[model samples]
Target: MSQRKRSIITASLLATTLLAASPALLAGNHSSHHGDNQHDMTEMCDNMREGKGHFNKADRQEKMAEQREAMANRLKLSDEQREIWSEMHEEKRQQHEKRMGKWQKKMDERCAQSQK
Candidate 1:
């Protein structure tokens, strides 16, 4: 299970890196004279975004369950451990959401400022 988890994490990281690198690839092709290529790029971006959203939803659910199980097993945990884990998990989750929200707001402001 640990190996599987590591593999999933590695794969997710690789996918994220590849996705981030894609804009460079697209940008490199800007000298292309083909109009259809632009349309294809737009379609690819839309499809990739939709696919990523679905993948993230499913991946997050699976990771949460796996994390709980792994923590329980590694800790030789009891019911009390489970309760404590839940509290810790919720706290971490809320913190992450808050951080992400702030990050998103900052990014939006930067984008808006750049546009202006």
Candidate 2:
């Protein structure tokens, strides 16, 4: 037929091929990263803290400190970078403490009201 029709047909074929291949391409990429053991929901269910149970605020701070050390080691952070990281972490901790203080005050007020 016309050149325009031929161009349209070629474009349509390319688009169809890509659409057909997309899911398989994505699945392959995802599986390649994790490999063989894909579904971990059964194991994840064992950790209720990860799903529904309330995580302890005290434990969170301790875990964050541990994770920060692990992360610094993994990244091979420089001395200056480590200093900055510590400062950032301290600032975050102070903010968290302030938030917790506000939350405790609210909780105390509610308790006092209920008791009256």
Question: Of the candidates shown, which would achieve the greatest TM-score relative to the real structure?
Answer: 2
Q: Tell me each candidate's TM-score.
A: 0.44, 0.46
**Tens digit of lDDT per residue, candidate 2, span 6-60?**
9999999999999999988877556554653333433333343253333356677
Question: In model 2, what is the error at residue 94, expressed in angstroms?
Answer: 0.8
In candidate 1, position 44 carries an lDDT of 46
**Model 1, runs deviating above 4 Å:** 1-58, 107-116
Predict model 1's lDDT versus the native.
Answer: 0.73
Who wins the lDDT comparison?
A: 1
lDDT of each: 0.73, 0.73
Give lDDT tens digits, candidate 1, residues 1-116: 69999999999999999999998887865466588766665554554447565326568768887988897899888889788988988899889879877865775565455445
Clashes of each: 0, 0
